[model samples]
Target: MPNQPKTPVKGFRIPVDLYDAALAKAQSEGRTLTDVVREALHRYIDAD
Candidate 1:
């Protein structure tokens, strides 16, 4: 996706617990939080 932002997105607000969970999941998978979140959002959008 060449159109993806070159920098990390900032200032988005989500629950601390949710953030922690996503962080842990990303770490355990050896991936970035952004990658994890992006995949999640993709899945969610495609789910319907």
Candidate 2:
């Protein structure tokens, strides 16, 4: 449904190497990996 509030989701799988890379990038930016993922999701939705 449109305008539905986002709820937490878990257990989405990625390749181990990609996950590690994202974690490193997030750490270098001084943000939790969750925060980085959330921001990316928001930007993607906003752009659509």
Give lDDT per model, in order: 0.86, 0.87
Candidate 1: 10-residue stretch with minimal lDDT? 1-10
| Cα error of candidate 2 at position 14, Å | 0.6
TM-score (C-alpha, index-matched) for candidate 1:
0.65
Q: Mind giving the per-residue lDDT tens digits that candidate 2 earns over 1-48? A: 359788777768899999999999999988889888888889999996
For all candidates, what are the clash counts? Answer: 0, 0
Query: Which lDDT value does model 2 have at 30?
Result: 85
* Model 2 misplacement above 4 A: 1-9
lDDT of candidate 1 at residue 44, scale 0 to 100: 100
For candidate 1, lDDT tens digit of each residue in 1-48? 569669855778999999999899889999989878788889999999
Candidate 1: lDDT of 22?
82
- Compare the candidates by TM-score and give the number of the best one: 2
> Which candidate leads in lDDT?
2
